[model samples]
Target: MTNLNASHASHRNFILTGIPGTPDKNPWLAFPLGFLYTLTLLGIGTILAVIKVEPSLHEPMYYFLSILALTDVSLSMSTLPSMLSIYWFNAPEIAFDACIMQMFFIHVFGIVESGVLVSMAFDRFVAIRNPLHYVSILNHDVIRKIGIAILTRAVCVVFPVPFLIKCLPFCHSNVLSHSYCLHQNMMRLACASTRVNSLYGLIVVIFTLGLDVLLTLLSYVLTLKTVLGIVSRGERLKTLSTCLSHMSAVLLFYVPFMGASMIHRFWEHLSPVVNMVMADIYLLLLPVLNSIVYSVKTKQI
Candidate 1:
């Protein structure tokens, strides 16, 4: 164990935990993790390829779905190296700089995922509420603009988190609570006052995930209202069916995410392994599930 307290923050290495209660089982755990990771990549790759190769699928809704798939793959890749190292080789040490960088990319992709989901919700709203002008309203130019805006917002919101974590001095054990680097986990290990970091983290979450969820809900509310106005019962059911996949994706993401956040805040007394599992489900399982959900629900995919 390196003495992190005696050394400068830059010189210290953080220990990444694989699983809290079962270090001996990490090697065995690698098999399932690797299988799921392979499934995730294959699933997302198929989606992107299908969307690109098919001329009929070049609509705004599929465009947003492509963005969501890209975000999921990026987020998964950001954490894959460290996770593989920990579970496969019993190698858990990560340099401070690498950890910070990992944390940055993870957060950036996460925010982008949220934004993409919101965009998908908006796509559903437009398509359901006004079917005739959906094409004109969400033309290619508009879709490109939405993509750029989502990326820009994600970068701006997460740009400060690395610097914020960098400025804090770490004078305690550097073992993180999860397999991957996260802003919340990293900030907790800092010895200095984390009031600013904590507050900023809260604000970022509220603005990104919280706002995204609210907008998604609002879009669905309006969508449901529109569905009710249609006279034909079959038409109403047909219209609602289109939203099922997006709704599933949203719940898959926000539910585990909110559960993990709540666990961090209110369930500290629970075993650290529980926290690790929740975080894993949010980061790893959600992507695979998203790919699966869209594939099963969307006939085009």
Candidate 2:
């Protein structure tokens, strides 16, 4: 009876304590992930190459577009390599420090991207509403200042997230459920109370992601109002078309993001695989689609 009780206790412990296994052991999962990563890299690379070769594309919009492409490439590079290795090479282990670093840069590029998108929307608004002042308002000096401000803002905002994570006392459970070390998953492993960490995460989300979306929406609203006041129906339609493309990209990115957040926070029964895939759609797929929409619709590429 004593031996049987001990065995039961061991099995219960195994069941209660989540342990990560080889993610790539499932071939069905590996192939789709591999293909998506390849597509993301290739799409961003081609955009950057075209921007470099076309001298006419050196204006503020394409300049920012080039920066956007580079950010997407960097963002994918940060997460995809490790994800691919885990799924294809059967490597499931990541050191705790490396995990923190990954989470840091992931948010870093994410914040920068958000800031860049807001800047892009503002650029479009000015171009459409005040074409005469467009060149003067968004001159080379102003673009340089905007770039500097974006980098500074991103650094200031995201610097504390990784530091906060690093200070937390992680217990023995180093295995993250998702493909990467998401902030919430890392916090869950902490033996210490994580109220502060959770609050900080929420703050970052509200200020960076929430604020960016709000500002972008506001810019489009004002742009649309101004465009409607124009006398020419054809001109108004053209402006609406451009704004619609941007709005479509924004909705594609944000809807999935909010959905994933809700599922991860409220719905525990949903599979971690589904959550990670949704995150991939929000982070990687949206940016790739943004490049495509802007390129084809605006005829800038």
Candidate 3:
């Protein structure tokens, strides 16, 4: 009876934590976080506007960049509210349904961003491997279709997650590890059997983000092979230069992401603060860094 009552209360209500060990530091932390988030929006917005206005920037590469920018904004926005509420106002209470929706958006936008990076890799590959046929191959229609396919795949894969989470009875403590809800965090609190949720979550990450990483690596390998065949040292160097920004963006995203994931799975002994910091870096800092690298490095941008 006690367990059932705890489950009932926890299922309907939850409290978000801001850096498990430092409540006093949350307000101070909010400043840097808020500043970086604002810069992410401003920088990405400028990039999107520039791409839209410039007729010369309407190619496949720029289009993929635009999609990525939008996804980054969305990905950041999903956590902005809960994070700010916890840091500035000390308001950590989030309803169950709202939490689930937030998690869904975060995963969707994140997966979409991964897909966009893969697309960008392919764009670079095609541009370098067959410069002449690039325009014809990645035409307007093709770009549109790629965007649709990416979104559809994300939506389809994540659609069942909410249902899976909803069925679980959260009988454990309602205090979350981070200021925002995460699928993994939520699943861990469930008192009932979570085999299905765990299995499905693993499957989703493996097939979506994992597959994206593999595809991006393959695209780069093929691109490198093609670049090596180039006889002119100057031409090869110039071609590789075009890929520098994209490579930086990928590292900015995947490094922190992989770090956070590893900490969650293998290093549970580590401080909760490590996971919180890493999550912020992955979700918040990555977009700001990506905007800076692309804007400063890409001459056309």
Candidate 4:
């Protein structure tokens, strides 16, 4: 047998650890996670339904909101099934292919979610900056193109990850850090040199998520600057109020993910349990929190 094929044959499966240090308590862990999942689905689902049914919401801003809802749903579903299986059924064993597939979806959807946030920031900018041209600039066709572009960019950026990881032979310990498959965590399981994988992952993240963050910030800055042009203080406050929900989404979406990334990078001394909890927070908090924020803060919703 060839060396590469032989190595591949040896490591076809992996184990997902739901949480560290409490093997016997795995089933109980399922309850809280399942509860959170239910709430997220309902909350985001309601937002989507409201947007779809309300004829008045057939505009650029709400269309982007719908895309955000869909992104959140995608993010939650990408990880929830395996996570539940791990904790509830003790089914932690996953084939290599399956693990890679899950990792691909999680990261791609995550990137798409970030891209959507950036697009919304741009929407806010245009609405506030060029109010007269808002309708004309961001018509239905433009919104559709923005959504497609976000998804396409996410797909193109993340499409290489599975293939990159799959090319590497994972003959080492096949245990993952959490219930879900994350690119960084999965890369650790490979026995081969993962320098290429790590470098590429870092580059993709920096270019996609990192770039999106910077641009989103620029959009908000410009938006705030434009809002300042309104003469009356009350008018300025009212104009900025329209952006509160989006600002909340941007905060909820980026903060935890950035925290998790930092933890992964600099603080390896922390317990695996801490990392696992942070991963859950990063994945669980964004969608659920964004749903509530938009539902409450958005007047039309």
Candidate 5:
């Protein structure tokens, strides 16, 4: 009887508070949030459309750029509806299944975006290293294959997350801290033993995001080495300049990523109010900043 009742409560609805902390008095903040959503959509959507029709922009770099834009859109869109529901309409109640589904999409696409960025770094390395054969090496077929591989990898890696979440009995407070479902935040809400959840979560981050970041850095290092060997200073400058936008994108994404990780680990030490504020910025700031960065830095955009 006790176990059955526990299992029933585990499946009960979960509440989503705006950002994971106490409510803010400034309802006016929604105006800027709405602007961010619009700007990100317009900027990235324009780039995606332009890349589709322009043959000159159909090469690997822009192909990767399109993927990056698409990934950004996916990341933003995953949490967008729920966020708008909470902020614009003042709705907060989220069913357990809905929360899990949302969590799956967010982490899966988040991993895909990281993978895409790493692939973009490799694209840069190839263009810089073998300018003559860049097209031959990374043709349309190859880029398509790379995109498929990224999606496949993300799906397989994140496939176990929801199952892992389901295996645990969430008998405690069902209220989540953020407007959207996050794997780590949900894990904390599980009343059962979370050793599996915590350990697997750590493993996924280290193997997926950590490995992707390391390889991306390595690609840049090799590209830098190749560029430095060029005798002409202008040539070196031009070659390195191609990477400026990508570097900006990486920083914008990674800083918030690392901040969220640090906050997750040291959360007890910090003030409760700051957690919600930081989570709000971490989730929403990247796409807007990325759109602006690419538009200003990339000539074609």
Candidate 6:
């Protein structure tokens, strides 16, 4: 039985390789990506440091913002090293286990980001919609519970992705079209039937990303309505201003992601380079932009 399992796993191995002779393609692209990666780290690090050092920011909102920054940093780290290595040393071949590890963390941080955003929305809702109850509702214990809830949701939603990938038979093509082992791209290399993998992927999309977006929108909708109800213009503006950072960050992250996913899924004939560029935009650029959007707009961050 053990030999049988090893055979099955061997058949499932995907042979990844770097781009031929010219291992490194565009050296120029690396400069910008490297800069952006630095900026992302710096921005997120600043936010986290501030949240930790400043006692004034011990509230639920700042806590969630710190988590958001941390998640962005983690997400960027998961892919940037491989991307940079490809650009610098031309080491494009990732081992099967390493590839799977990258995919796992990518999904993990992606889901965690979604959860953080949702929790931020909820925090804003309580602060704006129920100010009087905010203290009672989001105290220290409550914040801990919320943190656990977010982590739990992220873990539960993304757990199946790596497991499903492990179970799939990949006896066919080994080369992944993209730089990373994206779920869909990996599925395409499967020798066995991919129907199960595809269906599970769809379920993850619907529950993890889809539900998070829906909840975020619902929270903002209610928040907007509450803001409008305020009679004092000064108070209303202040409330909306507080939410601007998070709202902008959400748009920056989700819009391009949805667009890229739609293009990849429906418009299969799109250029592979185009898809790679889009992935970079969604994964790296978006996180860097989120830091800027939050810090510049919400100076408190």
What are the lDDT scores of the predictions, listed in order?
0.91, 0.73, 0.91, 0.88, 0.85, 0.79
What is the C-alpha lDDT profile of model 5 across 211-301, one tens digit per residue?
Answer: 9999999999999999999999999999999999999888887877888788888765776556766666666777778878888899976
Q: What is the lDDT of residue 56 in candidate 2?
A: 84
Cα lDDT tens digits, model 2, 43-74, are 77888888889888777777777777777777
Model 2 residue 181 CA deviation (Å) reads 1.3
Residue 205's lDDT in candidate 4: 80
For candidate 3, lDDT tens digit of each residue in 89-109?
888999999999999998898
Task: Assess the local accuracy of residue 28 in candidate 3 as a C-alpha lDDT between 0 and 100.
Answer: 93
Per-residue C-alpha lDDT of model 1 across residues 182-243, encoded as one tens digit per residue: 99999888878999999999999998899998999999999999999999999999899999
lDDT of 5: 0.85
In order of lDDT, best first, we have: 1, 3, 4, 5, 6, 2
Q: List the residue pairs that clash in candidate 5.
A: 20-177
List the candidate 6 regions with Cα displacement exceeding 4 Å.
1-24
Instruction: Encode model 4's per-residue lDDT on 1-301: one tens digit a residue.
Output: 6986775654788888876778888899788888888999999889888888999988789989999999998999999879877988889998888888999999999999999999999999998888899889999888888888989999998998888887887776888888888999988877778899889988998999999999999998898888888899999999999999999998888888888898888998999988877888778877888899999999989
Q: Which 10 consecutive residues of model 5 have the lowest summed lDDT?
A: 19-28
lDDT (0-100) at residue 71 of candidate 3? 91
User: How much is the lDDT of residue 49 in candidate 4?
Assistant: 89
**What are the TM-scores, per candidate, against the unseen true structure?**
0.96, 0.86, 0.96, 0.95, 0.94, 0.89
Tell me the lDDT of candidate 1: 0.91
Q: Give the TM-score of candidate 5.
A: 0.94
lDDT tens string, model 6, 1-301?
Answer: 9876655554434443333333445555577778989999988888788889988877888888887888889899998767766666566677777778788888788878888888899899999988988878988888888778877877776677777877777655577876666778777877688788778878888988899999999999999999999999999998899988988888877877787788778987877666766777888887788878877887665
CA RMSD of each candidate after superposition: 2.2, 5.3, 1.5, 2.1, 2.1, 3.5
Worst 10 residues of 2 by lDDT: 10-19
